[model samples]
Target: MAEITLFAAPGSCSRVATIVLEEIGVPFTYELVRFMKGFHKSPAYKAVNPKGKVPALIVDGEALTENVAILSYLAATYPDGRVLPAASTPMAAARIIADLCFCSATLHPLVTRYCMSVKIGGEEGAAAVKAVGAEAMKENAALIDQRLCEGDWWYGDAWSAMDAYLYWVFGRFNGAGYDLSPYPRWQTHAARMEARPAVQRALAHDEAAQATLSAERMQMGPGGAPKAA
Candidate 1:
């Protein structure tokens, strides 16, 4: 068995990977990367993941970054279809892969640009970007809601890591003060995800790490920079 260690930050996109790890029931060490505590920028963490991002899965001391890559790995390594659904063909495998890309490459950046638009761009630019984000979010939510309405999960009857990733991205929109009531179906799906034992466990891991960050007085500032703890 490979010794695994996950360097994760609480409540970030890393939550998706954390959920899958719990779903796989794997034995791995959780190394909290306190982003606000300046650990992510630390030399030690950079040694682990040069990108200095959270949710870097270290397997036998080798690093794997990105939610899509990490999820794909857990699926391939565990081969239990817990991280993802077992595909009979390459095309079937690509289905979920495409969805992951949509969430990570597409929606993820939109939410960040939307939520942090004011910070990223000036007030005038913020208005322009916010409108774009709103429109894009609505279009994506409609597609997601339509698909989710067909099945209990994204694939229409099976729960996969994609669900976790969707929950994270969609919830980020909601968290950013965008109304999700229009997509009641995905909202319900989000609630269902929240009720999962595995999800709860992952959230627990997140909360514990956040509590530590809070105690250390290293909460991120208004501009996303770490404040002195």
Candidate 2:
């Protein structure tokens, strides 16, 4: 068993990586990177991951960053044939990677803009950036909704890492007060995803990480609300 340790933020995009690990049935541990406390930008975390981002996986001491890269590595290394398609199914594996890439490269950027335009875009231009991001996100949501129309999971019968990834992505949008009801298939998919045993386990892991982060004095919002920014 490789000594896998993940440095991740609690409910952030890193939750996708945590779900992938649980879905693969890997014995990995979370290091509890508290973004609210600036631990991700600390010297220690920066040493582990120069980019100072969540979802950094330290596998037997070698570090891998980025959600797509981490998920791909897990799929290839674990060979679970579930969280992601196994290499034996070459085309399926390739498609999963592409889907992960789309989530990482395409969807995530829009999410960043939609959720953090004030930080990335200037105060004066933040609203405009957020508007554009919201529009683009709707387009992508329709695409995902179409994808979900095929079946409960992205690939129909079986669930993949993409399912967990989308849960975090779309869940974030919903958290930001977006109306996801228009995407009926995706809304149904969300319900099914929440009901999964593996996803429940993953949420437990997230709560554990959250407690650890809290103990470390990570800000629990001004009045005990959630804190990612």
Candidate 3:
């Protein structure tokens, strides 16, 4: 078994974990869990994580779930990786954790609600639910854009895991057809993130993995039925 095995779904929040792992330059294995094919819900994957979520990390034969927990673990285990601020006091650490919490608790959920409004609110009310979520997301984005105007990175002069988390959130919103042009600061921040070699590498890997999974699904046909010749 590899020292680390990250079970992830391409294009999901798992990209943040994969990017961090790449940034750390650690030797590990990546197990792709194709969300498109419902692999994440399969019994096999449920054995790894009963919650059926992506971004589960297996470290030292133990399973770690949740992005915040996994990120904290990586930071603690590899201090040199500099995934978070090197806080000298407890309050300082709390501040960093608070930033991460805001992303996970506030930003992520708002975007997800907007993206999955149909599922959350039923077909008849999906549009209204999505509108509410979109409005909330716009407010949150404006706040973040203002904060980003203060500096290049979220914490000013330092790029941390929070940046990765925020980047993922922004990417999700963008894909959902949210208008991001008004947030110039965020646009710049995203550009810088994309320029990172680690981020680029993770994105490339995710693209390849997603493409391969799509091909496999096609070959298997719908509901695992073989395609006509």
Top-TM-score candidate index: 3
State the RMSD for candidate 3: 2.7
Question: Each model's TM-score, in the order given?
Answer: 0.90, 0.88, 0.92
Q: Please write out the lDDT profile of model 1 over residues 1-229, one tens digit for every residue.
A: 8999999887788889888988888888878887756789899989988897887999997999998999999999997746787889989888878889998899888887878789667887998888788888888889999999788899778898989998988777888899899998899999999999999999999889888878778667679987677
By TM-score, the candidates rank as 3, 1, 2
What's the CA RMSD of model 2 in angstroms?
Answer: 4.0
- Total colliding residue pairs, candidate 1: 0
Clashes of 2: 0
Clashes per candidate (backbone, < 3 Å): 0, 0, 0
Q: What's the TM for model 2?
A: 0.88
* C-alpha lDDT of all candidate models, in order: 0.86, 0.84, 0.86
Question: What would the TM-score be for candidate 3 when compared with the true structure?
Answer: 0.92
In model 2, the runs with Cα more than 4 Å from the true position are 87-93, 212-229
For candidate 3, lDDT tens digit of each residue in 98-146? Answer: 8888987888778768888888889999999889888888788898899
Candidate 1: where are CA atoms >4 Å away? 122-124, 218-227
Give the lowest summed-lDDT range of ten residues in model 2: 79-88
After superposition, candidate 3 runs with Cα above 4 Å error: 220-229
